[model samples]
Target: MPLSDKHPTVKRRRSQLLNHFLAFFVFAVIVVPVNFFTTPDHVWFFWPLVGWMGPLALHTAYAMGLFDRRD
Candidate 1:
């Protein structure tokens, strides 16, 4: 369905998903290359990926209504 025709909650979830995806993309693009060239020996990209993934997972759950209290 088109975004304009979806319910408000659906629209909000879509927006959140898009925002999280873009943020992850930008972060990986910048951080991975910098960590690769600047510290080729250590290769610490996993640290950032771990940190970001935790919150991203939580965000996905919340956006999917895992935490919603529908009574």
Candidate 2:
């Protein structure tokens, strides 16, 4: 049997993925360059990158059901 596309979980996952993509795109396009010129001496981009990556990683794990409590 084919899976139902209208399922709530499926819809939530789709929206979450789209949001993640948009956030990453905005950070790459705008934040990176701005940080590059604002402080030419040090590469401060890593600060934001490291900050965002932590949460992003957790979000990925949760979305993949890795953190689901299996009883």
Candidate 3:
């Protein structure tokens, strides 16, 4: 299902999972040896990590009361 289509709790959990994936993706970008093995260096390996930072940052902001939804 589309992420927005999930139930509230499922959406929250999915958000958390996406956050973790982003965290792992960032780590993998630096840990993987693809840069050393590839003839032409590629930066695309960091895409997932970079993409994840947006959600992670927002989550952090929400957790820190920066969002202030007032609900």
Candidate topping lDDT: 1
lDDT of 2 by residue, 1-71 (tens): 32257878757866896798689778878877887779777778877877888888888776666766676
Cα error, candidate 1, residue 64 (Å): 0.8
> Over the full model, what C-alpha lDDT does candidate 2 score relative to the true structure?
0.75
Against the reference, the lDDT scores of all candidates come to 0.84, 0.75, 0.62
Ranking by TM-score: 1, 2, 3
Clashes of 3: 0
lDDT of 3 at 20: 72
Q: Candidate 1: which stretches are off by over 4 Å?
A: 1-5
Residue 55 alpha-carbon offset, candidate 2, angstroms = 0.6
Candidate 3 has which clashing residue pairs, if any?
A: none
* Root-mean-square deviation of candidate 3: 8.1
TM-scores for all candidates? 0.84, 0.72, 0.42
- Residue 15, candidate 1: alpha-carbon lDDT: 97
- For candidate 3, write residues 1-71 as lDDT tens digits: 22244468556765876777677766776745675467346645566566767877777665444555554
Model 3 residue 54 CA deviation (Å) reads: 0.4
lDDT of 1 by residue, 1-71 (tens): 22243679867886988899899989999999999899999989989888999899998887777877756
Better of 1 and 2 by lDDT: 1
